[model samples]
Target: MMKRIVLCFLLIAFSTSVFSGVADDGAISTGEYDYGIIEWNSRNPSLVVEGGANVIDIRNYGRLEVRYTSIPINGDWYTGGIRDIHLDDYSELLYLDGITDILGIDENATAELKGGSINYIDSMQNTDTKHIDLYCQSGWSWLYDDEDLDGIDEIVGITGLWENDSAFTIGFINDYTFGYDPVYMNINVVEIPEPATLLLFGLGGLALRKRR
Candidate 1:
């Protein structure tokens, strides 16, 4: 029981309000970029993208903790290859303590929704949903609006009970009638506790397996 407390602590500590690196170079505004990449085992084990990051890439076992920023991953669609926060291999993404423009999961990657707000999230169009394993942090979580009233529910617009009695919400809009993209969504966190204090992934993988 004691061990459980510690793991939850580590996983929930969202944003230090600082960044370790910005795209491995500088950042780009109102333009295109190769995007920031945290790759391989050679680089630091973790990178905090609190700000100064437009888009990001997490490959191999690198970890990306994002917050307090807007990250747009949908690139020039006509050119193809949108790397809006691509996750591959055993990479992990932890959304905590802030709002991000959007996130896209690809390959055998994993994402943990613990605190932060995510404007949008989806698996790569070509990959199975499981390819990018998504886990809701420790709490009560469920999908909303099963359009056809089918058993299938979406994680994109999730809602539920969080620790500290705080609540998180994700809203979506499909307004193609106005000649818009027709899809807009995000997790808006009014106020989430300072990480660590939150629970571990509801599925309990790395945290549960780790030696306390």
Candidate 2:
């Protein structure tokens, strides 16, 4: 019951990091940033089908340490929010915790998805290299959704297949030292059986179910 209460408040506090609102704006070509809210712009940048779009472009030895809440959950009247993050030409993007939409990683670029940005990191041009799962994220839920009424599910964990594939779990119940953690997922997970567990849910059709 205590965990439930904690998560409820956590969700409310974390809502602004994964979804709507206006955030700080700026541009970085060189220099290293470690703290503070960096929207880079009040725009939600989305990646193109061809791969490698840019909003926060890291190049020429530029480095961004996303240990805290870097990309704020935001958008503006001009249809702007953090849509794409690009790392190229030996630039670096070290992510520890935060919600990321789309990332374009090129040759000699470094985009390490550690703490929070684990599920949404994209290696736009580095499909050949194998990606290592640095952290073991536990206790999260991955659901299937096709809100467009199309045939595609939004919860694809397979790398690079959908550009937003999460290679790790999304649960972070105790990731924050403070009460205000800005890296939590927007949705709440109540209870849902894993697909493998669902496959063995006895002969009784009503024995197993999903409750969000």
Candidate 3:
């Protein structure tokens, strides 16, 4: 009886794994990113289609980092609010490089999703003004509370493709810390079942049928 149960479980697990796909090695590249769509501006940035036009639906990636470049500053700096987001004349507006799996918790932590600005880090030039936006399907809220020394923006959601409100404006979150301005943002992308992680499900069903 126990042997039969184990075999049933293994079958279910194998089926799930086969149906679901694997994730990338967290590689950051300037290629195409697919997530039920063939555009780089999808709400599910972490989820990518390995091949064909199918959505993998990845949830391991829980954060999206928005990066900004300032004059003469190298590497990434920390900014609490929008007061530090700067722009220079003719500099790049903003672009989405990649998504990560980092969650903001009021500490100096690292994230998987990281982006860099195209503009040079020279003090002679400064940024003008540019607004960045985050979007998802539904069931999410964008909250701003930079008063208690916490993170700048917080995205809350239950499930099913959620994005943030891009109407907050750039003047609110940009804040200068020192010689260099902060160029990173940590957006949360909660966990969801991907097609690549459904192996054990099939086994459970098979076991029930055999017993009957």
**lDDT against true structure, model 2:** 0.40
Sequence-dependent TM-score of model 1:
0.46
Model 2 CA RMSD to the hidden true structure, in angstroms: 20.1
- lDDT values, one for every candidate: 0.48, 0.40, 0.28
What does candidate 2's lDDT look like per residue over 1-212, in tens digits? 99999999987776534222222222321222222223331212311111111245556555655533334424321122234566667665656554456655555665555545433444433224432233332344454445736666555332211112334443222222433222222222223344445557653455544331
- Is candidate 1 or 2 superior in TM-score? 1
Candidate 1 lDDT, tens digit per residue, 5-73?
987775554222123233443222223323324342213546555453434667777777654343443
Please give the distance, in angstroms, between residue 72's alpha carbon in candidate 1 and its true position after superposition: 12
Q: What is the TM-score of each candidate against the true structure?
A: 0.46, 0.36, 0.20
> What's the lDDT for residue 35 in model 3?
24
Which order, best to worst by TM-score? 1, 2, 3
Best by TM-score: 1
What ranges in model 2 sit over 4 Å off?
1-54, 70-82, 117-119, 126-128, 131-133, 137-155, 158-212
Candidates by lDDT, descending order = 1, 2, 3
Consecutive 10-residue window with the lowest summed lDDT within model 2 = 45-54
Better of 2 and 3 by lDDT: 2
